[model samples]
Target: MIKLQHIYKIYEDEHAKHDALNDINLEILEGECVLLRGHSGSGKSTLLSLIAGILKPTKGLLEVDGVSLSKVPDDAATLFRREHIGNIFQKYNLIEDLTVLDNIITPLIPTDLSYSDVLKLADEALEIANISHKKYNLAKKLSGGEQQRCAIARAIVNKPKIILADEPSANLDLNLTMEFIEEMKKLKSHNKTIIIASHDDLLFQSKIFTKIIVLDKGKISDIN
Candidate 1:
């Protein structure tokens, strides 16, 4: 579960200060599939970053699972995020030269797991992402959809309890978008808390989303 209370994220320069998020408060329960719907500059991505512990709130409280992320030290937050959050970026950040399996195993390298255990986890993640056949292929050689699947596998290789996806369908065609929906459904079935920040209508129309929260001008405009 995740909770935010009176959260604010502000960016300041010498000349001006801008609030990326303002007085945003939300609570997402465990195993819920949630959508953050808004146009560009609505602070959706900023909200996701805050929840993932990549950005500390300028003010207010943020708690994921049971820990207060807003108050934690940066190193502690990083470790907590590594253990609990699976982040899927819009750009599908993969090492171009690495094989799919190797890319998936990269995150586990920093942990205490042995090489064999890392491979085991990567294998399981590949199976879940439906990309096992491409495990040996170079990341740059894969098609867009294949790369996306590889990214998904890498994100979830840690078996994170929460999955945060930012504009995951921005590059996909309709068919690939559908594939993403199906993949997210698989993650949901495993009781993963899924929060996606996207304006894509395809996701808005999907039946898998448990709640849709609309944002405008860095504030919650509506909730459905």
Candidate 2:
């Protein structure tokens, strides 16, 4: 579950203030697959970051799974993100030299799980992302699709409740993008709350999305 009430995200510097999001009020129920469709600078990414606990709203409340992220300290937010959020960025944020398996397990390094347990989770995630064969390959050596699979594996390895993907298909081909849509469908079947921010037409046309929200400038322009 995610809720945002009168949320405002403003970036202010010495000379000006830019509003990334303004007066956003939204609530996403559990297990819902939602699409955030907008052009560049439409506040889609900002909303995802706020829900993922990576950015605190400058005004109003933000709650994810009942936790008030806007009021928490940075460390607490980080912990909450690790525990409940899976973020897939547009640019695959993998360590260049690390192997795919190592990268997948990186998020688990901070937990108290034993080495074997960590490996178990990583292997399961790799299987789900269909990147098990490339598990030992270096991140820098993987192809675009392979790298995308690696990123997905890493994000879901924690088994997070809410999956936030920002422009996930930006680098993939049509076939790979279709594969991603299927993957998202699988996750939805597993009852995960999925939110994706992208302008991809394929996603908008897909049947998996339960709700489609279009943002204009810094506000919700339409919801379907």
Candidate 3:
């Protein structure tokens, strides 16, 4: 469902140029879960941003679900991301002032769906993420695991086809990490494609991944 060919990303400052990604070539099939493992500055997040159309590649081709993101206009890319890609960032990125349900329903606001339909979707997403009971709580009052689950619920509220997670377990305890991983596994059962950028060894140890890609110094170092 996703493809990147000869992709390159470079950031230029007045003093120097840094290559965030170099000649990346990757393909992820539908219903597949792929893990991207690497240390800091390894281009894992850069690759994810490229795939999600959050960043335009300096060079190369990118296609997600047959739409060529490399050629898409900025507004089109934004629309495509909203409709097709679900993102879980390390910070959870929840709106602090919004209730859990409100935050989860934010993405549905731009759609023409009725208020009842939006609420239904948010409730269903909370159920899938196992956070339905906390629907009315303020986001800041939730625990770390609860907040992470809330992030997942918000991401999948639109039933996006692809889920991109960047260091999702970075701030969690062992138990919460396991819980998050299990929740991700459940997503595969629903035929959603998941791509995770993490250095967590436990994730690599899991046999659920269809493949694992390692990045180093802005390029792919290994694939298995």
Candidate 4:
């Protein structure tokens, strides 16, 4: 579902030119769950960003779900990403003032779905994530694990084909980290392509991960 060939991302400014990813080649298939394991400055996050259209490579070819991401126009790519990719952030990225249900449906606001349809979608997502009980509560009132569940609901509400989770367990304790592992299992059951960039050993140790790709010095070092 994702392909990157000779991908190099170089950030250029007036003062310096820094390479974030270099000479990377990867191919991920449909319904495959891949874990990206690396320390800081290893380009794991950069690779995820490139796949999610959050960053563009300086010189390389990238394709996701068959589109030439490197050549797609910005406006088109944004819409395409919204339609095909679901992003789960480390901080949850919820609006503090919004209710859980409202935050879950925020991504649907851009679509042509009706109010009731949006509510239904959010309801289904909440149910899938086992967070329906907190649907009416404000985001700020929820616990860390609850907030993470809310983020998961918001992400899959669109039924995205690809799920990009960046350091999802970074903030959670062992218990909550285990909750995320269960959630990953559920997402995989739905046949969604999952890519995770993480430092958490819990995820790195999970048996559900089809492959573990290691990165170092801005390049892929090994795939286990």
lDDT of each: 0.94, 0.93, 0.93, 0.92
Name the top lDDT candidate.
1
Q: Candidate 1, clashing residue pairs?
A: none
* Model 2 per-residue lDDT tens digits across residues 1-43: 7999999999899999999998999999999999999879999
Off by over 4 Å in 1: none
lDDT of 1 by residue, 146-184 (tens): 999999999999999999999999999999999999999
Using lDDT as the measure, name the better of candidate 3 and candidate 4: 3
Best by TM-score: 1
Worst 10 residues of 3 by lDDT: 199-208
Q: Point out where model 4 deviates above 4 Å.
A: none
TM-score of each: 0.98, 0.97, 0.97, 0.97
lDDT for each residue of candidate 4 in 1-224, tens digit (9 for 90 to 100): 79999999998999999888989999999999999988898888889888998788889999999988888888878988899999999999999999999999999999998999998989999999889999999999999899999999999999999999999998899999999999999999999999999988888788989989999989888997
True-vs-predicted CA distance for residue 49, candidate 3, Å: 0.4
Q: Candidate 4 local accuracy as lDDT?
A: 0.92
Off by over 4 Å in 3: none
In model 3, the Cα lDDT at residue 134 comes to: 96
lDDT of 1: 0.94
RMSD of each: 0.8, 1.1, 1.0, 0.9
Candidate 4 lDDT at 78 equals 91
